[model samples]
Target: MFQDEARFGRMVRIRRCWAPKPARPMVGNGYEREFLYVYGAVSSLQGQFDWMITHIMNTTHMSEFLAQVSSAHRRDFIVMVVDGASSHKAHDLVVPENMRLLRLPPYSPELNPQEHVWDELREKEFPNRVFNDLESVRRQLEDGLPRLAANRASIRSLTAWPWIVSINLNAH
Candidate 1:
């Protein structure tokens, strides 16, 4: 599974949208600094996705998210591909017994399929929208994650690159 973390917040990014010619489109802007972190893992071959929303990004939270993913897939040994985040390499980080971390080379976000998941969420769930509060942002994430998870076909389509599907994890 490819793993990564994303920060979501009340800050809104104005995305391009279609507007009738000669009509000006109004986009709302948000500058609040409040933020939350989401930890996610996607299995491209199986189209299985796991995610957790957290108040902070730290070793403890990373460990907890690992545990959650481990619990969700008790029988499968997960070789999680992750980036070189400080929390990911913390000396005291608790990696679950059924999982192993494989670090991607520095400055290679494009290699992780999990990034496409974030792009999908931002494009679909948060396009041109401004949240009134942190809770509203959280609620949107809560809704989006499961909706994405339930659509196995969509998950596979978004993340299952040819190279990714070709690799053998030896899960048997």
Candidate 2:
């Protein structure tokens, strides 16, 4: 039940989590942390600041709103997947100083951990809903991120059926 984005006319529904903690914060005293889950896309350039697409393969736009995943131990990262995504195969992508690309099994979105990211972003974090504008959506997601990150199980459960109703809707 991962979240997916579809282009509808000119609007896009970007399912995302908002966890913008300062890159470097003062150590150990009392710091404020915030988290949010937002839906909808930026319709205009100004709106882009308010919303973003999570875990998208695209190279353009907010790097601040996204993060890349990799394993430090290659010995433990034995699972090789063949995700036939153009971005996975794109030659122009600028990964970290040294990163290797692996292909996931063709058409196997179910096996991807990222699938749960969108699913839970739209489900547990954000119940059935829509946003009127990008600001409102951003604020909502920004607030939801902390709770979402704390409960890793909640996000992982996104792959399960009951929580994945919307995710499986288009499968038929």
Most accurate candidate by TM-score: 1
Candidate 2 root-mean-square deviation in Å: 15.7
- Can you write out model 2's per-residue Cα lDDT over 1-172, one digit (the tens) per residue? 1222321111233343454675432222212222232222111111111224342335432122222222222222222222564543556544433233456567776655444455545565444244445455555566664555555455435433433233322211
Clashes of each: 0, 21
Q: Tens-digit lDDT track for model 1 on 19-123?
A: 899998897899999998999999998899999999999999999999999999999898999999999999999999999999999999999999999999999
Instruction: Give me the candidate number with maximum lDDT.
Output: 1
**Residue 167 lDDT in model 2?**
37
> How high is the lDDT of residue 61 in model 2?
24
- Flag regions of model 2 displaced more than 4 Å: 1-57, 61-82, 153-172
lDDT for 98 in candidate 1 is 96
| Alpha carbon lDDT of each predicted model | 0.94, 0.37
Alpha-carbon TM-score of each model against the true structure: 0.95, 0.45
Clashing pairs in 1: none
